[model samples]
Target: NNKKGSNLYDYWGTDISDVLNQDESDLIVNLASNEYFKAIDKKTLKANVLNIVFKEKKGETYEVIGIYAKRARGLMVNYIIRNRLTSKELLKDFSDEGYRFNQKLSTGSSWVYLRG
Candidate 1:
């Protein structure tokens, strides 16, 4: 089931130009969703997860294309990418036990792939 008022939906198929300019703390809070990210302490989450925001050049301006977060999981890695720019082949390369490239959260301009 999907939760309402979560940024998860906003992160999909939406331009994140403003989000890219935000501070690290604000960025994490903005991107956090109830579905996957349920941590109450933002500082703790920030310290634990490795976050990366991606951008792409669209004609003249650069647009925020994706957000990636990863945390250590013993020998493996737990990660998620809200992707609007990666090709299917490249996405496949990132697949792991928790997430498959084909098992995306949504269709169209963007997709959310989570691995836990």
Candidate 2:
């Protein structure tokens, strides 16, 4: 994930703190403080996350929703929804650059099938 920058690092730290201990009063008083409450295009968000997953593993599209980044190698991420095809289609395909339109067009398919 290209989420490796100073701004992202700082922003995530702040975001987590705000979410972890938020109360009803905080929610009502500091609506703007809830970064997660900020409007975001769900379609674009899903697409971007899927694109990142596809890059790491070709033909493997993951639907990610919320993500929590801690000061560790592992990140706590959530998926928007679970797709049955992910594991089956991802085992053989490896897209180091993630999923791209060109690749889909060249392959003449949107999602691919593969053997486990």
Among all candidates shown, the one with the greatest lDDT:
1
Q: What's the CA RMSD of model 2 in angstroms?
A: 16.7
Q: What TM-score number comes out for model 1?
A: 0.23
Cα lDDT of candidate 1 equals 0.35
In model 1, state the lDDT of residue 116. Answer: 31
lDDT (C-alpha, whole model) for all candidates: 0.35, 0.27
Query: Per-candidate TM vs. native?
Result: 0.23, 0.15
Candidate 2: segments with Cα more than 4 A from true spot: 1-7, 23-116
Cα lDDT of model 2 by residue, 1-116, tens digit? 34543555444544444443443321121112124424322322212112121212225642322231111002101121222223323323332223222334224122332211
lDDT of 2 at 28: 20
